[model samples]
Target: MSKQVVFTIKLEPELRDTFMAEAAADDQPAAQVMRELMRGYIEQRRQAREYDAYLRRKVEVARADKTAGRGFSNEDIEAEFSAARDELGQVV
Candidate 1:
């Protein structure tokens, strides 16, 4: 098992009391609730970092495609989609 340590923070008395009351209402220890909250916050930050990296990679790929003349123009895309829609309409 991993060793545990005490984590301390200072907050307003009213806020602390309210948090403790909510945890008690749920039949959970205040410390356990705090730990869960901390874990959730960490996961949220990790996901944000991952999404930011993914976005950066996508932007880089798009920029590289544009640089290599492999990117399409807005008009080209619109025309292609319009032609597809017309074809579908004909089929229906």
Candidate 2:
């Protein structure tokens, strides 16, 4: 990976010192840790967006099915299950 750009942020002096000390203790560069954290955050956001799109598509399809009368109603579902249970001698 090529990191040709420098990103700068301002933090409290104590926070910077503590972060540097922790990075030193872990034997890892602070920049590398920050890069990994940034990548993880990006991936999390991407997955959330994909999931949101999937749910929206599902809702749209359900709505279309309802408009076309192509899906079962709640009462229809309950009646079908009740009949199946009766056939199997199971309590409702």
Q: Give the Cα lDDT of each candidate.
A: 0.95, 0.95
The number of clashing residue pairs in model 1 is 0
- Which is the leading candidate under lDDT? 1
Q: What are the RMSD figures for all models against the true structure?
A: 1.4, 2.5
Clash pairs for candidate 2: none
Model 2 clashing-pair count: 0
Looking at model 1, residue 34 earns an lDDT score of 87
**lDDT over C-alpha atoms for residue 28 of model 1:** 100
Mind giving the per-residue lDDT tens digits that candidate 2 earns over 1-92? 99899999999999999998998899999999889889999999999999999999999999999999999989999999999989889653
lDDT (Cα, tens digit) per residue for candidate 1, span 3-84: 3888889999999999999999999999888888989999999999999999999999999999999999999999999999
- Span of 10 residues, lowest total lDDT, candidate 2: 83-92
